[model samples]
Target: MKRHDALIRVAEYDRFRRPTSIRIDVTAGCPIPVVRTIFGAPDKPTETVVNVSLVTESHPTLDPTRKYKDRCRLARRIADRLGIDEGCHVRVDAGPYATYYRVYEIREHDAPLVVHEEHLDRLGIDGEQTVRLSTTIPQETPEQVRERGGLAETLVDDQTCEGVLVTAPHGGAVERGTDAIASRTYDRLDDGGVRASLWLLQGYNPPEGSAVTAHRRWHVGGFDRAVDGYPGLATLTGRAFDLVVGVHRSGYEWIEVGGRIDASVRERVADELRTRAGREVRTDLDRLHLPGTNPRISTNFLSKGGDRGLHVECTPGTCDRHVEEAAAALAETIRRVLA
Candidate 1:
């Protein structure tokens, strides 16, 4: 696509942020009546003393008459006018802060753009800020979805030992405590002089009373883990890793262990979980239909060609209570297996 640019006064356009209640990543919205009255076209200005509420800060869509897709349509229109491709990245420069975002669907619209609140916060725009929106077609576009930017991540590539990778694709509030367990395992491994690459995906949801759960908003399945934009998963799959351990959560009373690995090694890991972590371990995952056996799954995908990986699914209680023991057990077993 040809390069396009727009020197638009953001916040001047009918901008709205993603509210806690809104499930989708809505960046732009239609201009409200008050905005039209004061800023654009209206016989008499209606909004004299507008009250900006904290609740509204979370949700700035004054006129939420537009549906979820409609909001995206507005942003896409802005992108199109700027000559950006449908799936290409748009480099948005709001003063000092700059971010690259992949655009969603595109349709024609002349309405002013309403920036999403998250983008505003990231760009450090308070109110009525001017931003330079530019587009470029990079040689190698990152394999990421529209909501990829919404999810937070941490990637460690400098320290890689034994070609081992630790991952928590469903981290933060999505899978509750999976991120913590994965983090503990990574830290324990690092402290023990076995530095490994790590990738953690965390949700940015509020603490309590959220209308939508993190899993609903940002959960990327095992098969899609490596395909998604996170660098750690890609690194694991790209290299010849001897072992790849994925931490996850389940609702069952006992922890479940399943992955593409040697039968003896799987049994050993289960036994260690039972003895060291003092938690019940289930090895009959094939019967449960969650064997994690597919080579395309992140656990197996990250491991060496033969699917030499470990997938550990811990219960909520196990994650909270026995994470340290579980991490130690995993590290010890992994060190031995690698050796």
Candidate 2:
């Protein structure tokens, strides 16, 4: 058929009876080719690469309408290449004209018409990708890990390890602890060739000691563990703080203690930690209030916000030992919060 004549017929067919979505891929010889003709046309075809599957569909013609002129143009070119004839039937099948097409490829040259089909086959185009990570937590009460990100299923039979998955915001590794809600960092490799680490924490509170020292150790330990498991992991970070101390107004235990620290100091601390850990840390100090009764430290670490910090109530009139222990834990919580 004459190219121009073929093009005109294709255009008319498109206007009157175009299917919603048609999938195509260019022949490998023409990695980036233009649609020359539905059957044949003189107009320059729209340019597109043949690396991936292409879906062409008609746009709505209703009021405030969108016209798929480009798509139609491409479709016409494909139809011409396929040698679609007048009797060919095209119909919509799924989701209101989502997945439907009818057109047979007519051989042009006996040299075996070549077109890339792998792109469409690999897409699993019929449905969406299913989330593979597990959401359940087996080590602690599920309630403890609720609302934590990166809470996927455990890969190992033993309860100590949890499988973690990470995705970079912009195709690179994210700072530790910013991606998941675990107590320590766990390294994860994604299918897209990106590396990330998941930090998971098991305890609700930090162990007692020098608050700063204990938390630093915890952070280092978590990172070390992640590195050991995933040698490719460049860094590891994440935080896990007791909600009781972090989210005030939850009617949780916290003590209010008039202290020297100011909001600026807290913010500065938080900033420093973010810089050091390469991740965003969070804490809740406003909600740290005594649960049952007021204590010596009516509210310790009250009005707190730091690079990484958590505020929680301490029992009033508690013995020095208890206060020291609580203070240590609170301090570590701050470190993790900042981490």
Candidate 3:
């Protein structure tokens, strides 16, 4: 469809719905390509302020009503590329996946222009705190909370061919849909003529055989061994995979591809994904290296054997809506890179 045909109308656009802001990549190529591959010439990531608490540097002086409308217009264009109905509620999904993400909540204090989640955790402003600042964090008793770390369970599908490892520490109940995303990715990697190990934290009840019996949160708790001394997540680093891939869920429509991938194959991978996922492809810039997967972070995926792993964050919507297509594309991209 033409650009003029894709205008967003909001009968009631709720911003505080999540309080978290997101960015959508609007380049070219819909249902078959929305930034993933459709309808434009622009190759830059567009900002969409979701949770209304957003405070940005650019357009800082703009009135609230005008800003909302402008964001809605940008969001509408993005959704249209994905075949989303006009006037429907939508949010940007790829921005949070960018290799670099501009964190706004830290603005409340004297913080850097851009920050990683790990940095916030170090400041004692953890994932829970971020949720409280943006979206809601459900309250549960310590007895019920998993991070206490008594159990341990990790699954490994090691083929030992390419020395690549695909991991999802937050899989299953830990992070909701992450396990499924990683599962598809694991199989995809295998199908691409390359072999690798896939590790998952499926915290068991009795710590069967070697799996951990505790149900602690992976990201936060995993850091103790890497940074502090927590034993729950200490073992993953020992695997020593050359290229570790830690996948997570995002809040935008496109897959936020990050990491300093070899310049030779970056565009090829992006193009493959654009055509497969039917969403726009965007590289990280505003947030170039997030602590979650950056090698600088002790517990990150990139710190593995080759220190070459990349952190891929996909929006909840895109992950669900384009899982099959995305898996095939991702596998193909890896195959191309290996070739």
- Name the best candidate (by lDDT): 1
Give me the displacement of residue 15 in model 2, in angstroms. 57
Model 1: lowest-lDDT 10 consecutive positions:
1-10
**Highest TM-score, which number?**
1
- Tell me the tens digit of each residue's lDDT in model 3 across 1-339: 522123121111133232121112323441211211112222333322332221222333222333112222222332323222322222211211101111222122431122232332112222322111211111122232344222122333322234666666555444546556666776777656577555554322211222221222123232321211211123344455556666666656666666544444446656777887777766653553332444443224434444466566666765667667766766676666666
Evaluate model 2: give its TM-score. 0.17
Over the stretch 216-315, how does candidate 1's per-residue lDDT look in tens digits?
4445552342232332343344466788888888878888788988877778888888998788888876654357777776778667884787888888
| Whole-model lDDT per candidate | 0.53, 0.23, 0.39
Arranged by TM-score, best first? 1, 3, 2
| Candidate 2 lDDT by residue in tens digits, 1-339 | 211111110112232222212122243453222232122222433211112124422223211131111111123443353333322322111211111112223333321111123211111234322211110111222233233211111111111112222211111011222222221121112222222222222212112212122111111111221221211121212221111122111112323321223455345434543443333333334532322112211122111221222222222222112333332333343434434
> What TM-score quantifies how close candidate 3 is to the native fold?
0.45
What candidate 3 gets wrong by more than 4 Å, as runs, is 1-152, 159-162, 202-224, 227-236, 263-266, 287-293, 296-306
Q: TM-score of each candidate? A: 0.56, 0.17, 0.45
List clashing residue pairs in candidate 1.
Answer: 14-114, 15-114, 17-117
Per-residue lDDT, model 2, residue 308, is 21
The runs of at least 3 residues in candidate 1 whose Cα sits more than 4 Å from the true structure, single-residue gaps closed, are 1-150, 159-162, 207-209, 222-228
